[model samples]
Target: MPENFAYPVGLRLQGRRVVVLGAGQVAQRRLPALIAAGADILLVSPSATPSVEAMADAGELRWERRRYRSGDFEGAWYALITTDDPEANAAASAEAEARRVWCVRSDDADAASAWTPATGRSEGVTVAVLTGQDPRRSAAVRDAVVEGLRDGSLAAPHRRSRTPGVALVGGGPGDPDLITVRGRRLLAEADVVIADRLGPRDLLDELPPHVEVIDAAKIPYGRFMAQEAINNALIEHARAGKAVVRLKGGDPFVFGRGMEEAQALAEAGIACTVVPGISSSISVPGAAGIPVTHRGVAHEFTVVSGHVAPEDPASLVDWSALARLRGTLVLLMAVEKIGRIAEALMAHGRDAGTPVAVVQEGTTAAQRRVDATLGTVAETVAAEGVRPPAVIVIGDVVAVGA
Candidate 1:
């Protein structure tokens, strides 16, 4: 965090009285932290925003539900004066001064006896940055430090102990930044990472030099790693007391075969944590300026895997039923069989001219959208040289908010 002369220190306010003079935006913003700190909050405001009122209704704070009164800070260890009326704010600050209680004046920071530092916590560590003058800069610095710590960029080179287990992390739609904070933190602590070709490939570049990365790519109609081999690798490393991360693309459970890995870990008696990611089913369409379900345009949406052709005996999807729905359809892993899928949809009951939009490599630098209809989407995709890792959107909602 950035340096300052504010002499930052954290106050232990658990079960202690803390007075707040207003319940407007500032109070609404600051009250939650106080409540989380286990402070006994006394809110003196005639009215509050719906959010603040709900907090009061839930008994999170003691709300007087009236204008500020003299001696409101009599039993308070800390006071926050934020009323709309300058006179009320000044009076509360003066009372707090006479009582020798520390106070923060939101209306006039210069007159306040205390300043609130931008604060954040990660991995059992509390970080506070105080810039007395630039609250925005303080917040930015605090965020940077916390992010670095969580991503292991600032982690110590050696640790007294290491956590041995396996984590199934959903890397999220090919964007490194889209990975969850918890997932990133786990990756930073990992000794080995088993990654997929379709996962957030960029994140692999950020791993430390000592971290081992294994390509567990399951390329379509190409080179791949057998499921048994991948499972064995995970169990083997974990049994050797190494921290392992199985990084997959999109949601681990959304056709990513995450449960299979989890079950494998369970049978091996290895601890496994599964972290979900943003699936392309909805996010991909939104990235390409399409809403899967727009009011009146689409009342519902269905997601299906098109890896198997409609005529294939292994296919479980009911093409006829899907065609009868007057909503949206999202297909994943269907680029290889889009022609057959489109034919089945049109042959059943769906309109041949239904609007369609295919987003390739959604949420990445190479993302591109190809527009067509159910009647010609296959041809359009082929003519445009579209490839796998694309999201297919079919419905009137495709054009509702385009």
Candidate 2:
């Protein structure tokens, strides 16, 4: 085999046949990329990992459930020889070579004619790096390039055909990196982004110049008007044949009022897609080193919106029932009314000395955590100047991780 003679080219594998000689770790690592490229994969193996088996069961690929045979590469445009048996790999490679199909060998790359480069995708661009058989170097370089592309450090404009519709994307706990891949991809292709205050703000700077960025907080008038205007904006832009993204912080359905916006869009006869996000209710506490549910410590975890005090007529949460549960309690948007909420819990039979942790602006650089007890949490929050966009965790699990 030559030292550095591998010609790199992106294969248009969509609707093309590809064969894998194994279903082990190597195949597991390679299958996802092949699947993403829309390749029709034929996997041959006696057994496979649960993940691979799940993919096959889901009809994403064809599984042979047997050992690789010599003529397995008959109609394959590309082949991967990933069997643990060196003889089987060599046999599969030879067959692929005879059939003029490029094959990659995971067991022995030096003996194979083709090599799989470290690859990463950002926006619409796929970056593949090959450092003369050095997988570590290739992966590092690929990661750096992808990071640059994601953080706006690398300026690559992705021009995509905009599908006119509304997508409610959960940006995930205040961190740009925490957003789901689907949400990020939708954001890249968005023509108009109606973003909330809690959404990842740094992502707005990465959007293309032609993309319209609307700050939901500054939507004229007050909070009610802002929400109504956001709903109207989504309908108006999508109706005008532009791809509109309603980017919110945390899970759209978890107190984000995403359902209301979705309903409004549906009522206006607009197509709406909701991309679920990592909710702050759980993620914030986790980021602060507090598990919402711990074995033996907490059997269950309940997430509740504390935007309204328990004493308020508008509040619907059963404070007494929540207090009776021997589990974890995760409260969101409760900083302003923590005193009343804590008081209500204690009065309703919850322990006054229950461990409490408040995580503010979690999963972000400005993130901070303040620890207290049920009796002292409200005063501690006031003294610490904890803000509204914080998560309050009350239960034994708060100390389990500590």
Candidate 3:
């Protein structure tokens, strides 16, 4: 088939059988979309890549675990043939043609009855680009179009109904680029944005002059806007037909009090969209060359809030249980109370000499790492003048990541 002769069309595969002849890279890459389309996929291959096998184990598709045979496409509405063997590919292609099923052949595009396009999505729009057999070109085009759509550079005309609601978006661990595309898009479309002191502070500068940028001023343990005041503000603006965006640092659900805002919206009969951000609990340690979990060294990791001292009645953390576990412990908002927390951990059976790394302002240009142990972390932090918005990693995985 020539490039000019290929006709593009969308296939609805819901409740339909789609046959995949191989489980290699091509199949692994294409299976997710098929599964998401609600296809009853039949993957016929001797083996599969680890990711494809995981999808099968998760019951996303049925794996035959055998070589393709005649009539494999007995009831298939579509076939994706990617076997390395030319003979098998030809046979499957023949079967698909005879069955009148649409087929995409990875080995040879000229011989294939159909071609796969480079696909991408932004919001509710799906962008599919096809430039003959030039997949890289198609992918590049798709990326450009999707990025434009996400950033509102190629804004769609006002054809769809405008939805006014509160969006609780996690700004990701202090990097403007780390914020999700949806989160960025929401910011672009926001009529009003209520921002936090932490998270990605640089993105606020990008908002247009018309967009009201409210400083929530939620400095940890400092003078700040009350939670009720913040909730009332979100409601007041949204009720007046304004598109409100509540932007916070890290994950909105991860100690960001996002759910509280969501619940308030629900009570007021306002819709809310929660966009999850990369939590600093995991990302901060990772950005600081510390793997929260390392194979054999640490199998599990725990993230704890150290905002309050363990000895405080308001604290609910099981310090003894956490100390007993031989795994990585990630502490957020704990810089102020780290001394007491360290003492509690050591007193509750955690090793005094356990490796610890305190990552300050992770993923930003100002990011820095301080290394010590459970026994000396407090003294090291005090001596170094470490501040809030730092992640404290404790356990042997700290050494492994280092």
Clashes of each: 0, 0, 0
Q: Return the lDDT, model 2, position 241.
A: 98
What TM-score would every model get versus the actual structure? 0.92, 0.78, 0.80
Give the lDDT ranking, best first: 3, 1, 2
Q: Write the per-residue lDDT of candidate 3 for residues 1-402, one digit (tens) a residue.
A: 654567779999999999999999999999999999999999999999999999999999999999989999998899999999999999999888999999999999988899999999887789999998889999999999999889765766457668889999999999899999889989888999999999588898887789998888642323535887788888989999989999999999999999899998999999899999999999989898888988899989999999989999999999999999999999999999999999999999998999999999999999999999999999999999998889999999888855
What are the runs in model 1 whose C-alpha is more than 4 Å off? 1-4, 156-160, 218-225
Candidate 3 stretches greater than 4 Å from native: 1-5, 12-105, 111-113, 151-153, 218-225
Quote the lDDT for 102 in model 2.
90
Scored by CA lDDT, what does every candidate get?
A: 0.91, 0.90, 0.91
Q: Between 2 and 3, whose TM-score is larger?
A: 3
Model 2: clashing residue pairs? none
Span of ten consecutive residues with least summed lDDT in model 3: 216-225
